[model samples]
Target: MKNLTDMMKQARELQSKLAAAQEELEKLEIEGSSGGGLVRVTLTGKGAMTAVKIDPSLFNPDEAEILEDLITAAHNDAKTKAETVVGEKMKSLTGGLPLPPGLNLG
Candidate 1:
């Protein structure tokens, strides 16, 4: 009974920490770039896109496809970084507890 009580208390604390971590993630930002830095993307830790930048040289009517590809690559890079950040935060918050695989938090 004592062990159960202690475990419940820890669960409550972990839940609180998880909520705070999620809120903090929303406020954090990460940047990723591709195509030799000609394209850049910024995303919040929660995987929301905040901004995108492209070099003026890449803005050519004949290179629309190239531009589109670069933008997609940059966005993917930023999203990957955001996922890594969130994963690290969650790991810390959970004290490295092993969660079931494929259970995405977001």
Candidate 2:
């Protein structure tokens, strides 16, 4: 019974820490650039895009497709960075414990 009680306490503490971590993750901003810095994207740690910037020289109508591709690349880069941040935070919070399959904090 004592062991069970202690386990429950630990579980609650972990839960609290995870919640706090999630909140912190939401507040984190990550930036990624592509096309030799001609395009950039910013994303929250939760992977939501917050902003995008593109070089004005890419605004030619004929190069719209290229611009679109660059934007996509930048967004992908930002998303990857955001995922990395969340993953590192979760790993620290869990003390390197592996999360269950299909479970992700990001």
Candidate 3:
């Protein structure tokens, strides 16, 4: 019974830590750029895009498709960075323990 009680206490502590970590992750801003910095995207640690910036030099209507591609690339870069940050945070919170399959904090 004592061991069970101790385990329960540890579980609650872990839950509290996880909650705090998630809150921190939600406040993170990650930036990624591509095409020689002609395109840039910012994403939250939860992988939601917050902003995008494009160089004015790529404003030609004829190059709209190219601009779109650069934007996509920049978004992908930002998403990858956001995922990385979430992963590192989760890893530290879990003390490097592997999370269950299909379970992701990001």
RMSD of every candidate to native, in Å, equals 1.3, 0.7, 1.0
The number of the candidate with the highest TM-score is: 2
Q: Model 3, 1-106: lDDT tens per residue?
A: 9999999999899889999988887889999898999999998888888899999999999999999999999999998988888888889888898989998667
Q: Give lDDT for model 3.
A: 0.90
* lDDT for each residue of candidate 2 in 20-72, tens digit (9 for 90 to 100): 99899889999999999999999989988889999999999999999999999
Please, what are the lDDT tens digits per residue for candidate 1 over residues 33-97?
Answer: 99999999999998889999999999899999999999899999999989988989888878899
lDDT for residue 7 in candidate 1, whole number 0-100: 97
Q: Regarding TM-score, does 2 or 3 come out ahead?
A: 2
Model 1 scores a TM of 0.92
Give the best candidate by lDDT. 2
Q: Tell me which of candidates 1 and 2 scores higher on TM-score.
A: 2
TM-score (all chains, Cα) for each model: 0.92, 0.96, 0.94
Error of 2 at 33 (Å): 0.8
Error of 2 at 78 (Å): 0.8
